[model samples]
Target: MKKKQLSIIENLIWNSAGSFTYLICQWLLTWIIVVHSKDLGNAGNLALAISITNIFFNLACFNIRPYLVSDLKQCYRSEQYSAFRLFTCLASLILCLIYTCMFGYTMDQIICVMLYMVFKLGEAWVDLLHGFEQRKMRMDIGGISLFIRGILSVLSFMAGVRFSGSVNTGIIFMTVCTWSFIFLYDMPQARKFEKIAPVFTKETIKKMLIEFLPLTIGGVLSSLGPSLPRQFLEAEQGSKVLGIYSTVATPAVFVQVAATYVFNPVLTEFASLYQRGEKRRFLKLLFKISFFLLAVSGASLVGGAVLGQWGLTFLYGKRIGAHADLFLPVIIFTCLNAMSWFLWSILIIFRELKALLVINVIGVIMCILIMFPLISKYGMQGVNDTLILYTCVLLVLMAVLVGRDIKCKFDR
Candidate 1:
């Protein structure tokens, strides 16, 4: 039986629902640690695990999903992408272990980091599968998989933590549950579209690695932009402080996630518009998306101002609520990050890989230059400030590059 293809609106709804549920579940893990365990340090440990693994997650993913979906010409086979992803995933896992050891983390932290990396590995693999479904315009299947995985993993984690009283145990449960979903649900759904046998040929693998290397490096640097601050905070102030910062910064992620949900469904459309020389319509769509991002940012700021502290208190406890000042800056940083991501998508559609790499490199350089001084002087607030600066610079540089590309190609 052939499955029906979804309209863009249906895709958006399903994707949004699935992503929102997954993100909310992820957020709740931190909340569960704080409220159930009554330990900010546990939350911090989890946060640190997440911070470290995210860099490697980017490495493994190599920002390929967007490239895959937007490959209008079908330049690469699904099997080749799968094979390449398998290689990256193994490399990321090994490198994660090396990175964790080099940082001289305690055994417990190392264990936690490894467990979380395994969990994130599951996500990375499933993300490739989602790309397959998305390329077929069946994001609904991907969304359903995400929704189910989210529910199951969170429940399993909560139960494990509740019963065992250890975050690592919960993560183990989460990891197991996630991979189960991948084997049972996601793989099946993706196989409906095509056979996902991994194909490894030297020529194809080398070509893919060479072509996507810039995006891979940019992804690592971009991940570092936000992560360096958390890493610094953990080194200087310890896990409790990082926990508070991670908790306070959690809500702001919705801005970026929401922005992604808005733009991702229309990415193919944007490509189509540009490829067809529909310049006016492309610009109009771009402006609409920008306006929507701005509106969402404003709403987030207002909400942060009005209910940020109280809400943090209500959710995670007063320890986190006390850092309400971080809320506004975090929201701004997230908004900027979201805008930068939108610009990145635009540049990707334009196939301006060098510009994308250069912009992210500059942002990362800015992060390294200012991260220490900011952290040394301002404490956690400095972390927020550093990220804001890095993302702000990225947003500006990318905007300029995107503008130049548009002028050259669209404006005539």
Candidate 2:
């Protein structure tokens, strides 16, 4: 029992450390890029290329990631991981190639996209690692992977950029190095629980593919919210606009990184527990934590945005700082949107696919609309307002659905 208590403390500390490292590294990298590349167009293009490549990565990996976490754990535990992994790799590689094809770009963009794939293939494995680790009842392996990325990112930033080529090269190279480490070490550690099954059958792949269908669509639509819109804004608005948005939006990443730290492991654990018939305890515990964290993070979003406004004004001159007001609402709405996301996580756990569909569908519709109209009229600030409205609606919807779910679950 004492051991259990200590383990929990260690997990929380490592998790917090991991998130803090991510924020520091991100802030430092952004500052360097901003200082060196005042050409908003080039910086925006870089940001856009990164966005494009990541979106492609997310598209290819999609639901399969979480699918592996829940599904592959069965393979690992049953000692069937050899066949399971073979089929998983074939499927992932095929999808990666397919996603690569979908990226239409100049040679430079293509090169960046390919490099991103190599790095992503490694980094994205974190999803699978988290699943396997938590199934063994230890979340630290995944936490360490995150800490490693944070450390490398900081190291790369501290090394500083003597040239544009160097910074650009460092970005992908450092990521590749870190992710390779994760892919190498973490997979074997996770495989300790892996059960090598005899048959890697056609039916298994078909089943995995079928299960991924809804999630795939939902994911593509979801990725568009952050990734695609930014690119669109960069194209229509400009890189300076992208940089400013990124700067203002930086604090939200802190909230997200921290939220993800706790949320990802819990989501995996909850999915596993639900499968094992601990549904009642699972929902009760989830509801409490979900509500508390959502609220805390939601408040933090507001505080962060307010500070972001001041931070921007000071960092950039008044001319640039005037744009800070445009960003504050985006931060607020993004936080609220994040709260609804916690609720969605519960919905996903219960395989409430239909509800999940409705939620993402509605949120996407609002976001899409916000993209066209406000972007035309008010530029960044308009996008910020519409996002706030979008998240507000999302939270309202979440409250209604959660209230309904709670009442129905206990109606008897």
Candidate 3:
């Protein structure tokens, strides 16, 4: 069998397209719901729900996909990785359910949140398959699955909400779309690389979990750091303002997704370089990537400043567009946050899990302490300001830690 291969440009296109498609669909779906229902509050609630669910999903993921993808030693079989992902997905669902129930939401909110969980779970399963695809250099499969899933899920969501006038119904349709794609597309493609079966050795699972614990904790905190603003807005100003804030801030996600997709295909090469003592080449490539991310951030901020309001109105609706001015600063920090994420990836490449944990913990704590006060004083704009401050501090800390680690490891 010929091994699948793609150049950097090809990898960038497929991965970025797929990710962009999903995010656009999600953003569009939120817009559609908000517009059609004439209920900004519901939109905000959904945003908060999805945001919290994403935190859980990231926690469940524990940054394992990349850890699995970068397994140059082939220490574990595909089945074992798959089993861990499945276990985490189940655990995430269980924990999310418990948290939701304990908070005591209305019946509608509970149903909507649970359905979103189902949708996210299915997406998580596909992401595990993507790790296999990425390892095999078959990112085309990952691209195709994400693109198709995004299209179908959003379309189903639109149809459900448009016809039935219910967000819960729309979410259910989205879940169905995920399951259909997972079984029909992702699972079969994954099997072509290796068999798909659960492997549960107690000791092996425990060891893998322990090894990945720091990264996992870091992933959760990293997600929570940004989520603090949305959670606060939802609590303090109510869902309508949150909805507007969410929509205005949503487009910035593209910058982060693009950076990740662009960098992903080269991760294996970084690991190989490190393994072969090509420290100079590794560090050179790392700096180049970081510089590219900075360029991307700069471009995004300029673009947002120019087209922020218009773009928001075009994608969402006029109601949401009123807050579009917030896009500029929000996107600036988003780019910074994206760069910080890239730096964390460097730490992961070096397996510096403790540093990753420390960086993210401090970031989250800073965000929390300042978030409430800012949101209270400045309203929606304050949330954006708080994020910018948090990301700046976080980015500096990560850059310093990662740079020191590289020097210690490769300075000769």
Would you list the C-alpha lDDT of every candidate in the order shown?
0.89, 0.60, 0.82
Worst 10-residue lDDT window for candidate 1 reads: 30-39
Scored by lDDT, model 1 comes in at 0.89
Model 2: runs farther than 4 Å from truth?
1-10, 64-107, 157-167, 195-200, 268-284, 298-302, 313-320, 393-399, 407-412
Residue-level lDDT of model 2, residues 319-402, one tens digit each, is 456666665566565667567667666666556555655766787887887777777777777666666676676678767887
Task: Return the TM-score for each candidate structure.
Answer: 0.98, 0.80, 0.96
Per-residue CA lDDT of candidate 1, range 167-282, in tens?
A: 99999999998898799988988888977889999999899899999988998889988998899999999999998889899888988898899898888878888888899999
Sort all candidates by lDDT, best to worst.
1, 3, 2
Residue 242: error of model 3 in Å?
A: 0.8
lDDT, candidate 1, at 188: 86
Pick by lDDT: 2 or 3, better one: 3
- Stretches > 4 Å off in candidate 3: none
Candidate scoring better on TM-score of 1 and 2? 1
lDDT score, candidate 2: 0.60
Candidate 2's error at 198, in angstroms? 12
Query: Of 1 and 3, which scores higher on lDDT?
Result: 1
Q: Write the per-residue lDDT of candidate 3 for residues 256-285, one digit (tens) a residue.
A: 778887778788778788778898898888
